[model samples]
Target: MNDAEVLMNPNDLVQFLKKNPEYFTKDDILRFCEENHVEMVNFRYAGGDGKLKTLNFAVSSKEQLDTILSEGERVDGSKLFSFIEADSSDLYVIPRYGTAFMDPFAEAKTLNILCSYYDGNGHPLASSPEHILRQAEASFKKHTGMEFKCLGELEYYIISKEETFYHRSNRIGYHESGPFCRFCEMRTEAMLMIARAGGKIKYGHAEAGSFTKDGYYYEQHEIEFLLTSPILAVEQILIAKWILRRLSVKYEVEVSFAPKIAIDRSGSGLHIHLLAEKNGTNVLIKEGKLSDTAKRMIVGILDISDAATGFGNTVPTSYLRLVPNQNAPTYICWGEQNRSVVVRVPLGWVDGVDMAADANFGLKRRSEKATRQTLEFRVADGSACIYEMIACLICGAIHGLGMNGALTKADELYASRNIFNEECTSFLKTLRRLPISCTESADALISKRKLLERDDIFPPGVIDDQAAKLRAYNDSCLSERLRRDETLFTECAEQYLHIN
Candidate 1:
């Protein structure tokens, strides 16, 4: 801990210090503390609100550090969640060694790792978000003999401290480098930090949304991660959010994930692409068309999109982002290459073309046909309870697989063309719609609670708590009121600008 001991740079990956970067046992983590002259150990985990919580321990000696890491620490559940009773609030937070990382901005040499909650009987707490996701995966694999994998398209806006010379038009700042995108450098550094913290990233880029707000400039950016298991994806996303918020402090700016930043500005969405795997191979694509299991998942998501909004769209103004023609889905439908529907089947090398051969001469190789097929659900946004949101989706998929008439429902909800177009107005009227208010979302969840409670993966307390909180907003009529009042609209939007 001396000043003369050279400090490790933040961009340096801590996994390099291990024999295997992907494996981190207790002995390996303990050896890291001893060999690297570590001074502090931090235990981080997700709480009821889906925010990362931390409890720090200063390593007085190797013995003290060992005990802290092995035995874990106790926490008050009542203070962290609304559903937990105050009388029985004691719970344990145990560290997950695989998530260890070097704290980038730490003044002291510190090692940070994520943790999981455990009950008094030394079992994972059923109400824990981490446990619920793990259970869902196991149940899904047991029932359908398939694994659930997801890819998240994380979107956010970076508000610079002052205005820049480049005047980005509303919803037109997609992929401009150097001068136009002022926050490109900051966004890239965040990507590196996320990578160093064990995130599998695909790419980062500018998005098609920008606006000046509250005397500051705001430009949109997105960082997409590669496909991973549902549990791993959720953890990576929470870590990414933590790193971005911390990095924003150094640059003296604000980073927000609110669904609707303004009335007409392009809202940020947490779009997720879901893939199904069986026997170590992707089963999502069959014979160059949508597979049966994949179709069921799409229909399942469409069936529960309205109810699932309780977990995704948390705030009152989130309803504003789901309006028609705003690049957000408003109806219960699926489509291929159409953005107007809730579930979209993107171009996934369906035609069997070797896309990489033309770009690289030496890399002229064909695909194994085991990957690249995905069904993207675009209903959720940034203010989501990520653990429950994903769990709900997986349950719906399982239910869809077992339900009758899935093929019929899928065909009925398929939209070949944009349903909002002038020619398809009558067709759009026939389809069902998403919830437009907090109250409506709560009512949908209340009615469809059995869907989520089927496998016991989703705790009843969590479901009840979520419904109660959503109903408490009483904002079912707020959207109608805000339409005629601009002053009140801005005031409501400002409160949630940095809520995530």
Candidate 2:
């Protein structure tokens, strides 16, 4: 069967597992592999910097499959980050069967499974980004008896292969279909590929940003995902990125996830919409209004908004996007339908609003009730590690939920003003500004280590290592600017103009 057919009828595998009792056994996997003509399998994992790394092996026989299943592949963990020393750098990769999918971009028939990292002694790697997110997921569920669901609106820019000299106006690319949207067909194919790989894609569209320079025209676009469990969301994000990257190569285009590609242009953002559910009810919405827990979560996020910037906006270029009047958030605040705040509660129909008056009313209400109750975190950019970013957000919410008074104060202070306005600047001055640079954000993260390190969610020393890396990156950028005799803005644009 084709990949789509196989994924569509997942019950075939489910029934096989039910009959076998011991699913993913060497024999079972070999049988399936043979039937599917899977010549190779790749074990994939997230490295320290959240980049996906892989180890591929030919799976021509049952022996190979058995060997792979019984003896997981060893990797040099020290190379990944500060996870291990060279003397004892051994790590293991254990494949997750549920994540296995046919590689749509592979030249030959291949299967890819996302792997979990384990230490030399067979213990879970605490420094692993996936592990950190898993722990956070468990902790959040244990403490609140609720499932955390997340939907991501990932924005990126597609650059043309042929260079052009004409510079287009800024902020004019939103939903501009037809001739200007060169990569729309590729995006549609990517969405289909994502679905075949078990990802839920809500929609894809051109975003509000386009510019031409050095014979290349950069057009921004976004693909949004349906709400799913935290772990699934992370997995889907990785898969989506993989699809985009592979497809870009085929299309002779460059896809950049960088927050700000130009000095004076709209930057890409990864706006996360979060929801919490208890039993069968949406905990984020109570009686058609924001719940106390939801309010606290928002307050908690804003409380450590400066520190949290390190998690979402990791690169030096990320801060360039956060200026006032841009689509990016510049201040630590929340407001309904305000894109200028760190967190935005989009205005939609009330729970019981009439569908006749508004076409979107029923859809909005159904989404709130069944899919999610909304809070859009607008601060995060494309540079973030997906797992780490979500974990930090969850931790911040936990911290915020415990401080009722602080939450109340934050709600009173920020739930109304449009911080982008001149009138609100004075009020914004009272609230903390998100760190303006990578170094400053790293320092904030170091200061708030306690908040993120609670319950061992962050591996010991991982935060320190990440902070040091950020500082080094900042130092390198500074030195490069000085060496080139270029201003910081020009240097930033040069370094990040094509970065993915």
User: Scored by CA lDDT, what does every candidate get?
Assistant: 0.84, 0.76
Per-model RMSD to reference: 4.0, 4.2
Best candidate per TM-score, number? 1
Against the hidden true structure, what lDDT does model 1 obtain?
A: 0.84
Residues 1-500 of candidate 1: C-alpha lDDT, one tens digit per residue: 22222133232334344333345677778888888888988999887777898899998998888887899999998888888899999999998877788887799889898888998899999988888888888888999988899978899988775564766645488897968888899899999888877788989999988777667777889999999989779988998888888999988998888888778788899998888888777787778777998899888888888888999888988888898888889998999988888999998874556667667775856565455888898889998988888887888788888879999999889999988889988878889899999899999988788888877888888888999999998997998887678788889878887665
CA error at residue 294 for candidate 2, angstroms? 0.9
Tell me the tens digit of each residue's lDDT in model 2 across 1-500.
44554445433333343332124555665666777678888888877656678899988677778788667799998898664679988899988766666788888888777888898789888888888989988888887788878888989888884443343545487887756666678888888888767677889998888877666788888999988877788888778887898899988888888887776678899898887778966677777777887888888877777777777888877877887888778768888888888888886456655565477654433333342467888988888878888888888777877875965666565747567567875787677678877888889899988988888898758788778767876643443343244366666656765443
Supply the global lDDT for candidate 2: 0.76
* Estimated TM-score for each candidate: 0.95, 0.89
Clashing pairs in 1: none
In Å, residue 32's CA in model 1 sits off its true spot by 0.7
